[model samples]
Target: RPVCHTKPQPGNRESVGCLYSCAQCSLGGVLIAMDTAPWALDEKPEHEEVCEFRPYTCPCPGATCKWHGSLEAVMPHLMHAHKSITTLQGEDIVFLATDINLPGAVDWVMMQSCFSHHFMLVLEKQEKYEGHQQFFAVVLLIGTRKQAENFAYRLELNGNRRRLTWEATPRSIHDGVAAAILNSDCLVFDTSIAHLFADNGNLGINVTISMC
Candidate 1:
């Protein structure tokens, strides 16, 4: 129901026939598009891609979560339903996931708050094949993709005299982390390497976020 509405021309006295120079979003953000049709603003890829008012789904580490709502409701939902998720402050922190060798699908979720924003860090382990286990670590911003573009994140695993690291921009909650996981765009490792980085069945990852 977040439709776009047209704006009147500077000197226009009548509503109809006025140049549809801009479209106002329901969230009170004005999108200026002189040559674009006001009716087409709803489907405009540029607008739709970064519009903060768009509906967003839960970015929790699992696919079973079906909650979806406006961007503003994300934090409240995360706080209430994901009460077990750990929250850490600062741009650099260590996310320690206990029992990395746990069998079957497992997810370790944590929230990182810095620079007046919330970031979700997810570490998941799953058996992608019959006998091979894969680990994925990714960071997601609890904001619009436009806002997410302003930040970048880094994930590092250090142990056994070796280090593995991945650095990239944080994906927006709207964008989700599924595609990144499917494409292996995040920090990925196999069970063997996971054990190499695990200390007493726990894995500690150095996570850092910064403005870009």
Candidate 2:
């Protein structure tokens, strides 16, 4: 008698490809392909089917529901909403420009002397940096040589001993004081003076002097 083979049902749908058996004259059977399409002659049953869609959720705080096409889309949301922002560029240093108008024509001698006295006190105190140091240096340089010399002597004497000292002479104190202020890390000069000088042609000499 010839035996007939039964077709597999949905419950046994583990194999999606076509199946074939030997001639009815023999009981021997073999799987042509383990996992292949039905169109190939050596094809076997497919164990798993391809999924059409996969569900996902938004990475937002409220567990917002949304389908993201890729992980790239999620990155921006995390960065703008969750990640901290930073800048690659460094901070800029601003310089103040001042205009000094005089009633009468002023000679370089007078300007230099005035600036030396004004900047000498500032250079004595080594607390501030940046705007303070820059402005003081500019003013001192513009003043007379005698004033610069006097300021210099004062700075050397003051810094010489553990006790602070002042000199009555006129000398350029620019180099010594500048060196001290620049070397000290904690020292920071007032920046407001720049705004004051820029707004008004008159130098904020009193403000700068008081800071020293």
Candidate 3:
């Protein structure tokens, strides 16, 4: 909630209350915490959940991004800072990752706009413990968790008469894609399988998102 300046009318002693401002949001929006008995701010849940002006971190692929700001400013920041990422307009598309056998940790990211919302498709390759490499692919909606629940996504890899598919609901950007990769809660496979799907050093994974 935000705080707005108010004045008490004559003979209205009970209407008087102290006003407190909240400085949690980066946009410097005024949060009015009234001193009224029925408006106990402490009794409420965390403001981050209900605050429309809450801060959002950049969902850019790597750990190099250090930018964070209001929700309205995220798209512009991404457009400026991550211009290389491909942007697609359809709900079903193919994400091609070149050099699928690239050594060491690598990540590929793309933005998809559909259903009047934006989603990010991420594919990450990393070396697991014991010196084996694995790939983690996930889709994240650039919106709230409740909004993400209305949609489902699927990732499919096909080649050599073999197909690997993983279907599930898209995760919200509030829950970073990295968490899913760390938890292995996405489409995961080893280098051997990835090679099977690769054609001339390029792996094209089909991604489809649909309303639930």
Best by lDDT: 1
lDDT of 1: 0.81
Q: What are the runs in model 3 whose C-alpha is more than 4 Å off?
A: 1-54
Q: What TM-score would every model get versus the actual structure? A: 0.75, 0.19, 0.75
User: Once superposed on the true structure, which residue ranges of model 1 sit more than 4 Å away at CA?
Assistant: 1-53
User: 102-203, model 1: which lDDT tens digit per residue?
Assistant: 889999999999999999999989876768789989999999888999999999999867999999999888878777788888899998998898999999
RMSD of each: 7.8, 32.4, 9.1
Ranking by TM-score: 1, 3, 2
Q: Write the per-residue lDDT of candidate 2 for residues 52-72, one digit (tens) a residue.
A: 122112322122334343323
lDDT of each: 0.81, 0.28, 0.80
Residue 75 C-alpha lDDT in model 2: 35
Cα shift from native, residue 153, model 1 (Å): 0.8
Error of model 2, residue 145, in angstroms: 13
